[model samples]
Target: MTLPVSARMGGLAMAFRAMAYWLVRYRRTWRGTIVVSVANPILFLLAIGAGLGTLVEGSVEGASYLAFFAPGLLAAAALQNAFVEAGFVVNSALRRERIYSTAAATPLEPGHIFAGHLIFIALRLFLSAAAFVVAMALFGLIENIVVALAVTLAATLTGLAFATPLAAWAVTVADFPQLNTVFRFVVMPMYLFSGTFFSVEQLPGPLRAVAYALPLWHGVDLARTLALGTATLGMSLLHIGYLTALCAAGAMIARITYRRCLHE
Candidate 1:
């Protein structure tokens, strides 16, 4: 049965309340999240764009090493941090915290709870990407500051794409070891191969195809082009459409998974 409009609004309001609570709670631990977000681009830029860059004498795709690197790093950081926030944090809400249980007793539905978590994840990813953009700017890596908005949108959507699926899977995992295995085998490999540190064009044929299938590569490509002011509208739309599809599909699955997990 469908909920009435007023009831739906009430449920959404409860969801927003939950999202607000997360934002407030995050303030207490903002330092850790900020440090991690800031450190990733810096370490990668210093270690690769500056260090290994010294060895490679030519521009990558005609952009300086740091310029080519900045957007990819920003997108990768969003993927990593968003995966952690959505997976581990969602797991904690399901298990250690019993947050869903508490909310279930109230006016909120399981879908509302999941929606609230996704809202928080999206907001966190956007803010983190914006901060990283500023950091990249300070290092003189950004060619166009105006494109930060596009980069941030790409990063935010990319994060949500990962976040929803990870949240759904985390609900079914029996233990932390299983989750760690996913990171080791799945997340880490995507991070390394998704054109984050270098162009996927350098990858062998099959590997390049694999990178194209992954969501992060699309994000990296779009974000990098936006930062460099070189994206064609058609390509940008394709990337955005892929990420949006993943985000929508994953959110649906996460909603169903959350209902099952919370009910169990």
Candidate 2:
């Protein structure tokens, strides 16, 4: 049941290297990504959170629409940036740019390849979440430090849950536009309907059930409940279980797909 220390360190090292690759390989792009991630969340707050709050009633997630929705927006933004890094970036690197092929030509193993990309995703998540948190602090939206940490972690995990399989799925495509469709179709819709703006109870019965089924639904649930401190122990455990299961499932699917794509 216990893994060797060296094995664990090796995995960590692989992930570090993957994250480093982004900095070294595409320094300007990575910097721009950081800037964009930070800016996008702020814009969302001003445009949607502030603007739309005017039309709505009392509040959501315990605070005004801005406070209640801010962390969820942060979590969702982090989720988005993480997937964009792993799914689109990794897919292009592996397929179009043949980076994975080049790496495979060396002594590096397949698990390292997977770990490297995942590490890159994690780095993206951390940077994006941190930036969003800073924005939150500057704008005065946070209520609890523990809630802040929990929402950030939720954002990172939520991103991983979606990104791994999405990266694999991107391998089958011949053109980059397919990723655009995925964003517009899969990521965009899940984000819009995942109880981000209004409560899920606000949605009708069937739509509410569908939203509950989405991965981001549980993710936003964790973020929203934690931000507002509304979740009971049982509900918290359920949310964690849902996210963990989705992340595991995504990793499994990514592994199988990578084998098929990279095996010679």
Candidate 3:
């Protein structure tokens, strides 16, 4: 069942072609995205970080509330963006627009199509994360360039960890309402409770355990640690390992789901 090395390389090259297709299509649709990606972080920083931060500054340990809050927001924002790009969009391609179907009609295998789309999503995550980091800098939330880049990388990894599995599930969904439910029940709850707005330690024992189990908490913790310069090698590796495992597992699942959907 193993393909030759040349064949594998060719499949990857085809996947890149599929990514290029999305990149070109994005040229027309990117304006609205850019506005949201760039402005949401800044507005959140102003309203919540600066405004609510003042009220809770004394309660937060070690750093100002804004400083404590900004990195977590960056991680949460990346999660949101990745979900938006992967959820309904993946569903639309499989159902309404039939983009994946169209690609399947060509020589491309399902894995190539999936990889291409995933790559494009990763690119989007990186751009959005980088923009948010810059906004953090403008507000003096991030001081070091290396730290800013590390935070950005963490955000992007956090995003892919969610995006891959979400896309896998999106392919199996029957309608838009199902995706809506996921956003409402799943993504929204994580955003509100995943150590983004407050510390997980504030939760009761069971809730704290649940928060630790969620990917967003790991992401928020990693980004905050890097931003605050409080990262220990062991803890950083743990966060990275958790997110990386999710990303790898999700990609595997997506490949299987995509192959089924495309063949059907």
Best candidate according to TM-score: 3
lDDT of 2 by residue, 1-264 (tens): 888999889877875665566667766666666556778777888888779876778866457887778767876786688667766777787778998777767656666677777777776787677677766766666566776787778777777777776776775566788788878888888888888777788899999999999888888888777767676788778888888887777678777777677775
TM-score of each: 0.93, 0.89, 0.96
Clash numbers, per candidate:
0, 0, 0
Off by over 4 Å in 2: 1-12
lDDT value, candidate 3, whole model: 0.91
lDDT of model number 2: 0.75
Q: Write the per-residue lDDT of candidate 3 for residues 157-201, one digit (tens) a residue.
A: 999999999899899887789888888998999999998888888
**Sort order, TM-score high to low:** 3, 1, 2
Task: List the candidate 3 regions with Cα displacement exceeding 4 Å.
Answer: none
Q: Candidate 1, residues 1-264: lDDT per residue as tens digits?
A: 998999889878878987877888898988887667666666777788778877776888888877888788888888888768887888888788887788778777788888888888888888888888877777776656566677788888888878888888787675867777888899889988999888899999999999999999998999898888889999999999998888888888887888898888
Ranking by lDDT: 3, 1, 2
Which scores higher on lDDT, 1 or 3? 3
* Candidate achieving the largest lDDT: 3
Q: How does candidate 1 score on lDDT?
A: 0.83
List ranges where model 1 is wrong by over 4 Å: 1-7, 143-145
lDDT of each: 0.83, 0.75, 0.91
